[model samples]
Target: MNAGAVGSDDPGPLVLGPMLRYIGETDATVWVETSRPGVVTVHVDGREWAAPTFAVKGHHYALVVVDALEPGGAWDYAVHIDGALVWPEPDSAFPPPRIATMDRERPTRLLFGSCRTTVPHDREGHRTNGVDALRTLALALARGEEEWPDLVAFLGDQVYADDTSQAMREFIAARRDIDKPPGEEIKDYEEYAHLYQLAWGDEANRWLLSTVPSCMIFDDHDIRDDWNTSWTWHEEINRTSWWHERLMGGLSSYWVYQHIGNLSPSQLADDEIYARVLEAASGASGADRVEGSELDLTEAVFDLARRTDRHPEVYRWSYRRDLGDSRLVVVDSRAARVLEPQHRSMLDPDEMRWLDEQLSGDVEHLLIGTSLPFLLPPGLHDLEAIDEALAMGKHGRIAAQGAEKARQSIDLEHWAAFNDGFVEVFEMVMQVARGERGRAPSSVVFLSGDVHNSYVAEVVDAKARHGASSRIVQAVCSPIRNPMPRMVRVMMSSFARGLVRPMRFVAEHSKHVPEPAYPWAVTDGPWFDNCLAELTVQGRDLSIVWRGGEIRDGDDAHPVLTTVASVRLPGPSGQPPGALGWASGSSAGSVS
Candidate 1:
């Protein structure tokens, strides 16, 4: 192959990332968006891999899989478009492209967070709650101080396609009629593309994304708030005139942008929708530059997305990865839901079976990343279960209607609401912990967000048959930038403190619920701070730290990381820490 010529003055390709994705022992994927078509190349320590860029509805993207790297190897890399250097922006202070492949012996340190809104990170941004923890960490890495996490798992709500920011509204107003159908929120593929650009476009975060491998799962906000919360909710949304257009746009954009990067080359080969794109690209093969339509792969992808939305059983969005001695299972708690009125489930039967299989495996540590918390506070759990039960006609039809109304009003949809699905996954987790299927892992950790408050909770399995060996923990960090309203915060604090006993009592006597096999409570926090959570897993010990962004001396755009709370857990050989009872709840004040 001829080495592409480099020109110092030529404009480079890359509008967004050299974002790392799915780094394996032998290969890794780098995703990028470029202005004008050309061959997009990622160079690792002088070794180069290139892929032709393709267009979808006018936006250009390329996914270059850098293969044949040694395990545990680290390499500083660069990006070029049609032979012109692009990345490590001119006089850039941020670090350049560098990747460290997965190594079995190394401890997996990961940073996870969700629910960040797109807004300028200035003084106004800070005062209004846009002090981004992810951006702060990026700057710290840029300054050559902190080491990078092996991966950053964005749990959900990466972009609020349903909620419009002021900047986004301005853009919409300038280009189209804000008074039109679909209004201020995103309308179609063009708007969704722009929303992603807003979310990941900022330079500091962009650089962080370029270097650290990222995995994402979408929540309701990626399409619309309360998406598929219930069968009734789905029907209600379907009635809207623009809902079809919105769904098509959101899912298609998610496919091209977020979902593709989550899969490995091997996994991508199995994806029919993505497979067609590669086929299209290879058919009209180009070495360097190519016209947009030569490889456009939108229509086919959009058609599949529509079918998947309507008939979810046809496709599976959840995926699992084995990172050496540990395993990461990212669940699809949103789109793969079973939304039948009488049999609502967090996941469809097939998806649940898949999760059950993925749950059991021999590993030192098992991490389950879900957009919604698998285990909420006992009070919240019971409340959601009650709502779901009532909606299912545990009471009369009139009462069921009232329950459905309440469910929609309060957003009462989570794993707890779908008791059967929750119990199934929970049982599988416990079975694995007890070594029923394999050697019990040291810990089974659920890393989740979406509550807008951060906390740590440990399962209190009163029914353990042989003194449960594995430590089951729920760690949540939320709203890397967005802050809850004061009223909502107060309400959440009250829910955390005063309702567990009453709700549990209701569950005990209610005909709807079979008494829970295990109960849990908030042991560390109900801290309402816009923050991120990090976990370090090595051998039999697991430690978690929550960090919030703290702006100093009015430097809102450059907030520093401050520890909110932390805890450590030992292996199954040791006794797990005793749960601090519900009375120990610290909801009176925010942690930060």
Candidate 2:
């Protein structure tokens, strides 16, 4: 009910997006959630591709594959529903959708952040929180002041299905009894749909999604906090009465909304479930059908979601992309986890094998995007590892129970919790860095979120004490709108620093686990401002700059971006491995 072009004589069917997605050399995917079932046409470069909307449980959506565009070409585009131009409303402030095709020569620039909570963009909302960084960045991009990133990667927590805001809770209460089962959190597909609308329904963010191509992967909050953390946690959650419907709804809606666009045209073609839907839709002339002849794919799609969630190995939520010489491997750390007690692994064996195969170093930059940081701060990493060990009966029964409670309470399930997986990935990274794999990459960068704070860390190759061939770095940006509490920030900072000696001491003395081959430290920050990160790959050097919102003139309604920190990581120059030359400033600094 955004009323986008509502007062106009020609009202549009589009409700959600002309969202640019999966941009390849000569083709791109455009998605839209419409008000009704209709034939949606994507008009670009004087050519148009049309697709009819499909309904899944009464929600109408369409994916238009626009093909045969010149590489690196930028063209303004429009959306038409049944031949009436509906997008770029007459009084629209942002520019029309400008679809840009990717070329290998162009530098790959990506803007990424996670853990955003949707709220009104008003004086009250901005007083303590300032403005949402994504909204501010969208405005700047609209004004042509900030360069458009090649794509935006929303790492996780796109919506807090478990942690609902007051507004969302109010809506839920109105719909059903909040005193009933699954009181405050989302329970089904309809609730999930409304949650997405809350998250992306804002005018600025909506328009930004219209123009910028994006990819997303989910963290725990997308389902629930500490989702699939351990066998005990999984068993407990499964015992809950409403969890089945919640999981089904979460995964089903995610596929209908977010996951569909992540697949390439070929991938879609090869997908059996999607292919069946496509075949069925086409059989009834669904593609060329008139406005009312929509295909109801509710059962098939939802059934696929149920099957996928039940057997994660049967389908992959993880994906890989090649941008110029840089290969980005987006890991699905949540659902693909192997949580069996005796054989705990961060990734199931099949998922781990797939990731290892993707880790070859022929690309100039190997970027691994995991929802959880692959390399946590050393102290934090060791503590989580020790907790995992203790929880596995390294300690007595009572102490083990305490360890389990502590692990679930503090969210101790990260890469460090699974020592086998951590060691395998670390040694794999070392092999890639030292050219033992394929051609060595200039840098192996891990892009992560979900820690609720932004920071940078570097891995020191122990083999080469003085210097190493490849730079291994971890960059984290979180909470595009949500900020950590003051107490939580102070606690996390102190705990990160305070546990170093004790964690190392225990790791060295304990025979239950092997010590890490390399150690890392927090190089830049633990800043708690709501921020988004820009990671640019230029030539052989990769750099990250965190940007946050600020109110310089106390204009609560309009916040401007200030650099939180900037680190220009040059390709390994045979210098010391952990040199990590970087620059920084406070959140209000004007530094770019």
| Pairs in steric clash, model 2 | none
Q: Compared with the true structure, what per-residue lDDT tens digits does model 2 show for residues 54-160?
A: 88778888888888899889999988888887777667877887899888998899888888887778787765454699998888888888988988888999999
Question: Model 1 over residues 215-299: C-alpha lDDT tens digits?
Answer: 9999999999989988888888999899999999999998888898999998887898767557655764544223544466677
User: Would you list the clashing residue pairs of candidate 1?
Assistant: none
Top candidate, metric TM-score: 2
TM-score quality measure for candidate 2: 0.95
lDDT of each: 0.81, 0.82
Q: Model 2, which residues run further than 4 Å from truth? A: 1-12, 127-130, 284-291, 461-468, 574-576, 589-592
Best by lDDT: 2
